[model samples]
Target chain A: MIDMFRRRFISVMVILLLIISGCNNRQETSSTNEAGDQVITIRAQTFGDEQTRIQNLEEAAKELNEQLKAENKKIQVKLETSSFDGSWEEYRRQFILAFKSKNEPDIFLTGHEDIAWLAKGDYILPLDELKDSEAYRDVYPTLWESVTWNGHIWGALQDTEARPIFYRKDVLKQLGWTDEEIESLPEKVKNGEFTVDDMTRVAKEAIDQGLVQWGILHRPVNGPEFHMIAKNFGAQLYDPKEDKLVFDKEAILESLRYFESLTQKEKVTPESMTSMEWKNVHQMMIDGKALFWYGGIWNIFNYMDQGAEFDYLMENFGFTLVPATEKGGTPMTLSHPIVHTVSSQTVHPDLVIRLLELVAKPEYQAKHSVETFHLPIHERGSEVEQFKNDEFLSQITYMLDYTTFLPNHADFNKYGDAYFNAIQSVEIGKKTPEEALKDMEVQIQNDLGDTIIIK
Target chain B: MKKWVLPYLMLTPFLLLVLLFFVTPVVITTIMAFTNMDYSMEWNFIGLQNFEKIVSDPNFSQIVFNTFIYVGFTLLINVFFALLLALLSSYYIPFEQSGLFFRALWMLPRITPPVVYVLLWLWIFDASEYGLLNTLTSFFFSNDPIAWLIDHPMTAIILVNGMVGASFGMIIFSSAIQSIPRDLFKAAQVDGASEWSVFKDIILPSIKWPIMFVTVWQLLSLLTSYEYILLLTDGGPVFESEVWPLYSYHKAFKNLEFGYGSALSLILVIIAILLTGVLLKLFKFNRMIQSSRIE
Candidate 1:
């Protein structure tokens, strides 16, 4: 009886030890897989509430997934974003705080104006090595060239969309302009035959015909867009050569006087437009209250996404770069590129780059371009079968050649705010054209302090 | 022992919560106020420098003036209007529901979200010539647009803020006026007191506490309030609408000087505490309330 009891006890002990060993084996496998999970987190300081950018990011993710899954690999990515909502000043403030944090983002997006100064910080890894890869060489040349800093590739471009003019074709038809004449309008602008003066003349005719209430509409709010308008008339905010503000007072006054007449004389714009908000401009053109609208490619995408059948508007709409001084002078529109970058401080950089690379694939780019209705950053992506067949996109495509850029200075935010205020002052008749220019020049100089002044 | 136990038990959670959430943060923020730490709260104490910079700056002088202007000016305007509203809503008014209805209507602006109300005020003060007020003005007078935010920054802010202020005093004054004993009025009536005389003597004494209460409360609110101004003008063409809280927000966020912001906040707290003490003493708040309750 004693021997039997001892044997049973030994069997029970053996079973318990086996169970303990089995549990240990399972933990080892779980731990090993966790280390190999290949997940990356990216953070950016942007307006978090912007439904547009969020939608674009998701569409890009879906496109990237299609490519990654095809390669039998999956890269997990988490995006942390902070939005300032409206205030650029507050945006910059939060950026400084987040930038000072213990862990930095793996990839971030910023405008071309920010790339020159903040990119100088040593925390960001240079994109030179990645750009040299065959994958990047195949992307859009213009996008790559813009973000390149001091002859070194610094960031990757999502894409840059140029602001183009939108005009009502229904009004043009009523004025007896054939479809051919509308299509040939680009040549007219290019050949020195078309000027803003000519635009006013045509707009007046349209207004007389009761085509629309206003002749032209643009967001003249407190943003650098107003600076761009001012620049078109020879007002350069900064002198890149002297590295200081070179106030082209003569040019600024000329532009302001002409701008004033749009409301004050020609009645081309509503008197209320002096205080018109930015978002209001886009909405106005769609509602047919305004005859023309000035916006970037995203507006075109938004309209199409709204399920507005574009065939009719697409026929009526024509794109023009904002007019320069000479009749045939090259019209200019700014192409502001939103870039995606890998974080230097990230723990899983390899995973981040892999995910970025997957999204950078031509097929993914083309798919996202189609899904988002955004123009492509890849040469091949731009020439995709989808964009080739789309007529409205083709018209926007013609406007891409006219794109330019604004100052890439980090302090541009400070200068830009004051500059827009100056524009508002002129528009509202508070300050005469000359006084506003003088104020803007002084304001720009004040904010710039002793920072390196770009020409 | 029993007395001590009950009081301690009752007071323990209240004391602990105040210590944990409020006192501890204030202490940490005060320490931070001295530091120049920039990145990820990596603080190194610099001592008194942030405060010195704030005091010496020209902007600080303007900020102090703006704060006083907001608080002092709003107190006067808010009190007068509220008093008027209160008087109108009393039995003197012809409304069917006896001013509760009118009082309720006035309360609408108070209950509205600070953001939404600010936006609504913005729409009213739109810079366009065709804006609501602008259109009305143009139809009668000049056709040119008024830069409402820039030209009359302080007045615009005050009036937009009047919507908030008018309600507080009205509510308080109404309740206080109602509480006065009718016996006092009956005696005054028998003695041939006019309505004005009854109001001057009996009603005035009864509601002086509410007047002081609204005045002191409005002062504190106007001093610290930042949202309406922030939404409307962002304290500019220059720092025109800037009050103390806005000054702190600009310092921390725009200037990237968190330490300076904390220092500014500490100063504001000290000022508010001092202001509260002065008000309490001037009103004899504690003594009057206890005596009134006993009576």
Candidate 2:
């Protein structure tokens, strides 16, 4: 009996060991086979609730494979990806963890804001020395600024979009504005003839006249939109020469005051605006309860998906850059571009770069634009039929001329975070503008230390 | 020698598990607390700089206050409701066998996935008129839609967390209440004692151990848990609901300050240990561990 039990126990132990080891042997990276030809697997990743960018990347790979086939090249590229849900913070955290473990994909897409962090950490390969081609030149020159850091181009511009103010023309008409006056509104704002103050006054008048339930609405969370208003108030977040972020107290204070007045004094915006969920904000705009909404170009597509008809939007809603802080001040909009970056640890940097080139082409980028509602990355992309045929894209193309991007400094987010917190404090009626500005200065000083120059 | 060898061999699996899951992570985290490891993963030993920064930081006091409020109030709600429900279902309404049904119903929140649970709460408290609460209130009270989350972020988080947590204590306390001898309660009832008197005299004494266990367990759990809050408030609207664990999370993951975050977590560990000691003393743990009466 003892001998039989021992044998049974050993058999069970061996089976258990096999079961445990089997769990670790799930799958290996699949590679194509040829007699002697080279094969490269190019893994790429990006995160978004939408899959347009991933589709665009796959199409680019297919296009590259076709070209290689025509040339009889043996190089075969395979792409793998994980598209994250809407939480960018969680997405970034995952990327950082992957980067730390050296498990990052060969090529990845992220916002320009992460360029400094990624570059400084040497997690990404600098693309400055890559051979320049006519294809690279096809991209807009200003867009190059977004990809450059410390005299090195660390990323290729994947996509760009403008944050603009969308207004209801029907509400303006209800407020007793004529059709010609409504048509001239965008031009007036573009020329700085109508300032933010005038815009606020119009919204307040509409609210008072009961033309709309709410005068205006904006993004409920912290983002690059606030940067545009800061720039309009003459805040420069980066000092390129010193290679440090800047905190212009006066300009930031002015921006804070403007937001405070909108929520508290002017009462144009809801005091609890910043705490709202993104869905609520989108639903509000789709329902057309507000006279004007501060949103991104991508928000138009989101509203449509949420059941707002395109024709209804075309007839009622108009878009423009955020107006200047004062009359005759230069109007500006903010663009936070997502860029394709090659990882430093990639086994196939050249193949990755080739894939990036294919992805950055005007035709593919225009497809990305039309599908995702993100603006195109290249000049020729605007000429593509898919992009040109879209009236909203054509109309909002003017915003690109006056666009400014968030600073590409690692510590810039630290400053930007502090600025946003101050804005929230003011909007929620928790702190005065003066108090919020003081708190922001202290926070910036404490967080950035000597890295930021306060002027 | 064979006897010792066999016993050690029998314990090997459990020892390996303890080392892998508990001991290894603790050692690594302790070591990491002294290093300036960030997004680059370079472990530069920065000594106590991170700790010093945290101690001297202005937001430290606010974080402490938020942690205290979140823990204190959540524990109160969990304990009070759990004890009440335990008594009602186990004794007061035991005849109908509805106690089991009610306990299972309460456990639904605990069993329901946290993401789905928090999402339900978000929809219920959604600031828009389309939300469940707003729709109900507007129909009944003829009031504008109220932004429940932004207006009462702390209260919202406490209630959500407490509701889920109450089920944990309920299960424990109910079982403890059942374990009490029936003779004590029957004798009290025969002597013309009221229901409240029987509970205070007999039931409360028998369930002391469970109550203490639930209190300390929930206190420690609440001190560490930021998931529900993170999903709900995200410590936002100007850090009104930012708890210690959530703050550490933001510092480490969001700000990429791993060293500072590790130090913060280490501080949390120290606080948890100290609080455990205090709770043990308050509960007279040594006395409670002894048998209360001879069989």
The DockQ assigned to candidate 1 is 0.17
lDDT of 2 by residue, B201-229 (tens): 88888888888899999999999889999
Please give the TM-score that candidate 2 achieves against the real structure.
Answer: 0.94
A53: Cα error in model 1, Å: 6.2
Off by over 4 Å in 2: A1-36, A129-131, B292-295
Question: Model 1: residues >4 Å from true position, as ranges?
Answer: A1-105, A110-124, A145-154, A172-181, A200-212, A235-274, A278-280, A287-289, A301-312, A367-373, A452-455, B1-73, B88-101, B122-156, B189-192, B233-295
Q: How many backbone clashes can be found in candidate 1?
A: 12
Q: Is the docking of candidate 1 incorrect, acceptable, medium or high quality?
A: incorrect
Which 10-residue window in model 1 chain A sums to the lowest lDDT? A24-33
Candidate DockQ scores, in order: 0.17, 0.44
Error of 2 at A359 (Å): 1.5
